[model samples]
Target: MHDMQKELSTDELMGRFLNQLKDEDQLTEKQKRIMEAAVKLFSEKGFHAASTSEIAKEAGVAEGTIFRHFKTKKDILISLVAPIMLRFASPLLLKDVRKLMGSDLPLDDLLKQLYQNRLQIIEKNWSQIRLIIQEMQFHEELRGAVVENLFGVGRKLAEAFVSSKIQSGEIRNFPPLTVTRALVSMMVGYVFFKFVIFPDEGMNLDDEQEIEIMVDIILNGIRNKE
Candidate 1:
């Protein structure tokens, strides 16, 4: 929304997104405090091991105050997940994606934009995302809920986007799903390698510049030349 993709760090974007949503939701100061506390503790300690009292202590609120906003600890987890879904996993944001697929934009340009947008989202919510991923391994119901509510429609939209690119001869001919996976891997893999595997803080390249290189490699490797 701010067009500060290359300028802002992931933490800044996350703080901005959090503040924006808090204002929209009209969450009380105490509620914000509790939510922040829950994020910290849940990420540090497993949710099963983190108690309401510990979260309350971290937030500097009475334990009962958390119940004022959330019915249970699980509800707290859902609240943390909502911002991610609204930003990246929602179908409303698919309009821009659909336009990109249908437009005459260069594949490199479209993919560079897509990669930056995704990295911004992932970086902004890495903590909550990591927590959710960890918990989903043990919680079938939580995984099912995420799949049904977010991934189901999101996957279809992604497939449709990939199909559009294929029909236009922009990329190689392959199964839409395979194309989706390849594109996604390039995007996600860069983040994993750059931030997690290598942790290069001294890199001078911004997200757009780095992702453009990745897009070039992908296109050069995959383009169908008749």
Candidate 2:
């Protein structure tokens, strides 16, 4: 087949697998509506809580229409997961992050910029993030995808960053992998604390202030003084 035809076919397959595709990708109108509705309902009510009838109602389609496009509600959930993961895996964001990693900035400064960029992304996709976290335990496939797409892709870069800091005596001489995990844990813990445990409106510190404090705490533990 021609390259154009192959590309079109792949786009069609991608459309079937994800609700939020690029503006130019083509999903049939009903499929588009179904996907959009499913995503909203899933994000709001969750996979177990939201029903197919409700999705159909939200999409203004017959309940059977959803079945016509998908084998099960879990199928829709699976489809939604790909797009949510894609937001983080996007080429532009990866390029920007790669640039940051390669820059001459100090470790703390680099981390602050990285955190800010990631926080912006997390905030924008909080709904989907919540959905994935809530459901990942029950869905092995989803968990695997998250591990592979999210963590697997970034592991080498993280290790390299940690190693560089260690060699320069900027951070403690822990194993590169250990340092990377610790840093990630710190950020992840902070995100949960800020967003889940005690959401910002209740917090005393503003976002920038919170970021500063978190960075300070991280540096205090990891900075090498010897």
Clashes of each: 0, 0
In angstroms, give how far residue 49 of model 2 lies from its true place. Answer: 3.5
lDDT of 2 by residue, 1-226 (tens): 1111222232443455455343425567887788788878887887777899999999999998888877678766656666667777656558888899989998888888988888888887776788888887766666766776677767877898889888889988889998888778877887888788888552554777777777888888546679
- Give lDDT per model, in order: 0.72, 0.75
Pairs in clash, predicted candidate 1: none
Q: What C-alpha RMSD separates each model from the true structure?
A: 9.9, 6.9
Model 2 poorest 10 in a row by lDDT: 1-10
Whole-model lDDT, model 1: 0.72
Candidate 2 deviant stretches above 4 angstroms: 1-33, 68-71, 90-92, 200-205, 221-226
> What's the true lDDT of residue 19 in model 2?
55
Model 1 weakest 10-residue run by lDDT: 1-10
Error of 1 at 167 (Å): 2.0
Tens digits of per-residue lDDT for model 1, 91-113: 67666666665677787888887
